[model samples]
Target: MTVKDSCIVEAGTLLVGVGPDGAMERRYDVGIRVHEGLIAQVGAIEAVAYGNDHLPRYGSRGMIAMPGLVNGHHHFGLTPLMMGVPFAPLELWLPRFRAMRQIGNRLDTLYSAIEMLESGTTTVHHIQSGLTGTPDNWHAITSDILGAYDEIGMRAGYSFMMRDQNILAYEDDAKVLAALPEKVRDWLAPKLGAAATPTADYMDFFRAIRSGWAETSPDGVRVNLAPANLHWCSDESLQLMSQTAREAGASIHMHLVETERQAEYALKKFGHTAVQHLQKLECLGPEVTLGHGNWMTPEDLDIIAGCGCTMCHNASSGLRLGSGIAPVNEMRARQIPVALGIDQSNLADDRDMTLEMKLVWALHRETGLFNDRPDAAAVLQMATEHGAKSAGFGGLVGRVEPGLKADIVLMDEKAMARPFVSKRTPVEETVLHRGGRHAIDKVFVGGRLVVDGGKVISIDREAVMAEVAARLEAPETAAEAADWEMVNAMMPHLEAFHRDHPLVGERRPYRFNRITP
Candidate 1:
């Protein structure tokens, strides 16, 4: 593709951004013209049209055109191993992850990417600590995740979790403090082994992986160095990652104080809140997006706004994991771009944005003393534009407009657009109440069809399911539930954490699978 190559695509209801003016409710529909991948024309169907011969057409007669929903924070390869496990809050969820990581590299990557697209998402921001092992053992397996994303025809931002402090949660120091007895030492070896990969080595390891992943799909994937996640990430690692990402022209992602425990940890250890600590380290900026800002104080919210950083609200995960509700209303008031995440393969649940969407409304409605709340349209921005912006796509995506990538989703108009005759037509309300599998008619990534006719078109669904059954199933396929590495190491902590603060599973049986490796 030449730099100046242009293609035209015509669709109904082009939902382009109203520019930097922040007028999201307004849209322009002049059949999109794509030149070198960015949109070139957006207006009436007849005016400023694409060159007919060059622009291959897709007819979205009954579909609505909007920016593809971006998943701002996800652990990319969790799908194949999701079902048949327990939803035991974070503390309980950790040990289970070890058991599930035994699924190995190949199956995990493909399953995660495809499942994401099939469910109507087009871009992903993955907070990757990669598969649980030394990166050398896996050899850019997380990068291979983009292979699946490419095959599925979606855009992605890869953020490798960087940590120097713990050597995987301070495991190195914890390992050789031999004053502890031999029985204890013997027991400690496996846990230490799980965290054994040196942090610096992993950093180089992920950078090389990012390089390779980029080569595989080129423009389809963009990987940024991230602090991985909070709680486990050290101050030095966060600084290094921030510098690396800025120099690389990619954004930095991290889980900043996802829970109350993390908040408490930051206060006691760093003398400031989690956001404040990161601010002091100069880790906040437009190039950074912190996932799960559920425990922010009003002051913390100010810090996020002050730094121009973004927040990803993982609605279901926050509610499920018992992390506090993020102040979406407050963040929006500050003009801080808030985005959405499924937080799936969750050791928790499926990648269902509808569940998350509904929860966003529920939490804010219940909490607000007055009617102050995020309306449907505002949440839509969080899910789409704000998400892409947070993950670094910004104006290049997250909306249908001239000079923007034509990443679009055609929602099922039959169900979602009905009861609509101008006066009753509220696109945002339709999306919130009626949108789901039935409404997700097609999903497009950069003018390519990733989903069509309400199904994923890029991969063989049945074959993928077959692989899931054969490779990821039980009885000799994987390690015994007890024998898994991730589960054993973290199960004790999970159970203990739950002991103090038990999760009330309003929705029971959060699905997960055992990881033997």
Candidate 2:
């Protein structure tokens, strides 16, 4: 099948951008002309295709056209919860992740891609969690994942998470292992050895992936660096990641202060906060994107703002994992760019950016009548423009404007106006308050129709789901059983390590509660 070179996208109402007065700038009955995957012109439908009436068209007079959503910080396709890991605090949940059965890379990635596309997410920053194997194994699995995205036609920013310490807990590996029983320790020590890949290999892996993607899908896919977390990475790893990212002109998305204990770990280990230590290593900068900053202090915020780093807020993940609320309001007040992510743990256990947007809008409201909080427009920005920045796409996407990639979402205006929505209500508010995957009529990435009639057109969704079900239904393999046993054996020791670790520092309260004044 031959692909078209140009097409006309018609919208009943198009979200141009935020206006000077802080309202959504929408144009009625607009048309966008996309050629060679980039928007060539945006104006009246007749005007855009006046001379060339032969161009294929998408959307209609009943759909709302907006920039495709971005998931700034996502881990994997099959969620941990779906794999039988129940929700727990971040510290406790980390250990249980070891028990998750491995689903094939392509199938798992395609599963999440469909979910995201159905929910209007056209781009994602995929921060890969740990994968143990040789460099060749890493390359093969990474390729399979990226190939899935290519098949689904979704833009992606891929980063392999880098860590050389504290693979299972904030405490040192030796200390945690020492605290375990002899039987458990003997079995676990060999397993940990296989998981340890040299830090230099991580750098080489990034370079190899970057070079490969540059030739294949340079604009549609980006390769970046991710130093897993403060407690999980050494000073040398952070510095090397920072320097490598700068030299390569790539983005670095690292997990930082996701929980109160992580913040405390920094203070006890380095006599400073995590953000301060990042500064000390010269890792805090514009090219850096920090995931979760849920436990950041005012000083940390100030430093982050000065360094011009982006923060990807995983609203649902924080609530589900019991990692307290991020200082988004404070970050906004400091004029720092904020992005939204599902973190493979949205409230619905699905990758729906619309629902995630609603959560962000409602979760940060202060108690007082006049207290500042996220508005519909602000939350929309986080899912689009800000998210693009966090994912290293920057100005290439996140706006429905000419000179940008034609990644757009067509919302069913009829569904949005279901029963009755006042014409006075802004499209931003309507989308933020009421929109869901059901409202996503269609999705287009790079001027290609990837989803039509609320279904993916690029691949067979039903077939993929069936394959996944088949794999999941089978009995556990010997390797998987052993891994589960190791996880079960280590859980108590990990819990005790976290509970009794020496990093007991003062944690600032952030979650809403009944007690006040």
Candidate 3:
């Protein structure tokens, strides 16, 4: 229909990342029709557009309408896990991760959801991990987390922590055997179970659980599986996770070349980069999303793009752990899809994506995030459509328009982002570089309000914080506390290991999981 035939819901400005070409348009007097939560009508001032006649209309007011952002890769359990910690590099950080309390239950997950929504991230690809305490426990932990997301009215793609080999990132035998009074080992023995159970059993159990969750709500949760992470998973385990996700019709999220050490191992053991090996294994495709793909060779990036896979970059975690920035600009130049993630910030302590995106600007020159400085709009897209696409929505999300999920955020312009009245200024500049969470007035998903006025509409934030505090105080009781203590206490041993086992000098069959003919 032409503009004359349409009813416009004229807001101050309408930002539409329309079409696969990503043509962005700003129009006034735009009307939208919300039929079953999708924008059924879009046109100029005379046209009627989204939402119900009974609901609040955009009217002539100046609201910068834009698509909601997506967080393509994450580990929700890290919040409580990061309550308090000593700072260290990745090799040292992994050890600390072993002992952090699994304080993130349904409520904590909801709290994290609140923070993301407040920041305008409506969709999240939750790459959960460190959940293996006992049988059915893993399912319980993940399901509880997703339940919070559903109740909070956020859209999420849930990838489970599928580690066939390491149920828990257990301490090495030397460390455990030395410190574990036989009493502690015996106490944990029954829970550990026999070591020889087929890995498929774990896969089957989680798949059944995923199917059940999908059958139940299906809207809020996208349950997929992947190995716990590269360092934490074996080659067979990675292939099995990939195969399982394929059979289950679910997406995958795995850590690839996250650190210098991990990259070093792939070269030494596998005779190729981890990404190259996985590519050889036929695992790089739309069905897979690689989280924290740092240290990739030019060839590795090409393979990822050729397969139409996504590289979910975690900017916060990289800086905190001293891992180099992802070559985002290289991927963009090659037309590879890139998405944003928070990574282990709950412990390492950076959850805000606004800061994360800016980091792209600060270090892009070094990492080749862009040949020229990336424009604000480009960085915003990485946080939104690029992120949504990585989560498998492609063009269906990360934008405000017809035929897309109405994952949206309304910014309180009256707050910090002042003088937004100019018709010439781009909204991307305001949202990406200026507006902060305090400016978030409302957040929506599928046309549903999840967070309003910077507060969660569903859960009690105060109560959630209380539970988090309680869990944080007693990280010692849980297995996580023990693990962190063990890892840190043995820093000397790990340091010694690092001297010989430098992260740079490694590549083994397990590390380089390729399906040889």
Candidate 4:
């Protein structure tokens, strides 16, 4: 039966949490009672339905039930690769990305939601990387993005990236513009000016969006703030973002040290590491989430742990972009919460949290027999609990316990069992290794059956995708073609600007492929 006002979800095996000894804490023959979108009881089916015998029951009789996965860091559903933006280092890729033909907000958001939902992800932290519009424009865009989430029965935390400086490169905008040819410069100036909004206007825009969402949006959607990155935002922008997030009761997510050059840039500009500069600005607190902290130092870890901030690990993005491996094991040792994000750059080029977890599980197995490494439970926790916290849904929808929202995933037990195996293996391990969209039997978000039998029941995935394909099949418009031409014209100047910067040849604390001093 479909989920209604009240329902009972019965699972052959229910995964609750990890124990103190790192073993999976699971129960057999468990039933979860969801009422008014919140979990009311979790125990035997008879106990959960003692007085609610009239309630509908979802028969997950032999399936493995766990908390729905969270994607802590993601952008549009239509990935850059899909838009013809080839993978490059973050520094180089940023400019190339400006040339991608834009997709309609609703279509793009829905496409990603479908991929995440069918693969068992219930929530996503959407950090809008490109901000180019007025408040009125923002209202429509926000509505479309959040509207997509509401239509598909998925949860999302939305934030637009704010940047007031260094739009072209790490150097100042004026300097970069001065070095460019006048013809190219004139073409780029208006484009950049159109995206430029006053610092105060950004705060006002966020306030308006947050207020509107509180009144009309579903409980599953939230509004947060993102300052973009250290190089992109001015000091005033960073401080204001922090203040605005606190006032709005929202969280702040920022990209920091995604590449080694970013670290070197911070050192050259501020005479300190990016983490220290953030602390100096009083932005290193629990309400902040640092994305792709692959170049943080040991001292940075100390500050991050002390401030109780969360770090999102984007393993595949690092590998794909040549960014170094994050110090996830080190963060875990310091009692810092580490979350996993697909970063729209999963190794498979899809939004599969299960596969992301597997890559993380195998990537950080330190040297010898005595080294500390992430086990199955830790990785699962990153995907669920830590991810929930990072996405600004802390203590609300991560666990499948009483008082928590009923966002759950049901995996096919037979698929994981294969054509014969051992019963002694932990359920989390099996799911980590074998579970994926193909193995997801059903998915529920806030007592709503969003996906059933490996298909999203809330929306017509095939039809929507076909429409997107058809819409994209048309040839590029003149504006898009000219944008590509401008990108090509500006590449050499952009390259020279980066190559000749004082910190260009410096080495980060981490290793790289080949660095000639």
User: Residue-wise lDDT of candidate 1 within 321-371, one digit each (tens)?
Assistant: 665567677777788888898876432366656556767766666433675
Task: Indicate the residue-level lDDT of 88 in model 2.
Answer: 88
Write down the lDDT of every candidate, Cα atoms only: 0.65, 0.87, 0.65, 0.86
Better of 1 and 2 by TM-score: 2
Give model 4's TM-score versus the native structure.
0.95
A best-first ranking of the candidates according to their lDDT comes to 2, 4, 3, 1
Model 4 regions more than 4 Å off? 1-4, 19-22, 50-53, 506-517
Model 3 regions lying over 4 Å from their true place: 1-10, 18-23, 49-52, 56-60, 77-82, 164-197, 346-350, 365-373, 414-423, 470-488, 505-517
**Greater-lDDT candidate between 3 and 4:** 4
lDDT string for model 3 (329-442, tens) is 677777887788887562225456666777765556543443555567777778888888667566567877887766666665556456554636566666666776777666
- Against the true structure, whose lDDT is highest? 2
How big is the positional error of residue 59 in model 3, measured in Å on the Cα after superposition? 7.6
In order of appearance, the predictions have TM-scores of 0.83, 0.96, 0.84, 0.95
Q: Record all residue pairs in model 2 with backbone atoms less than 3 Å apart, i.e. clashing.
A: none
Off by over 4 Å in 2: 1-5, 19-21, 505-517
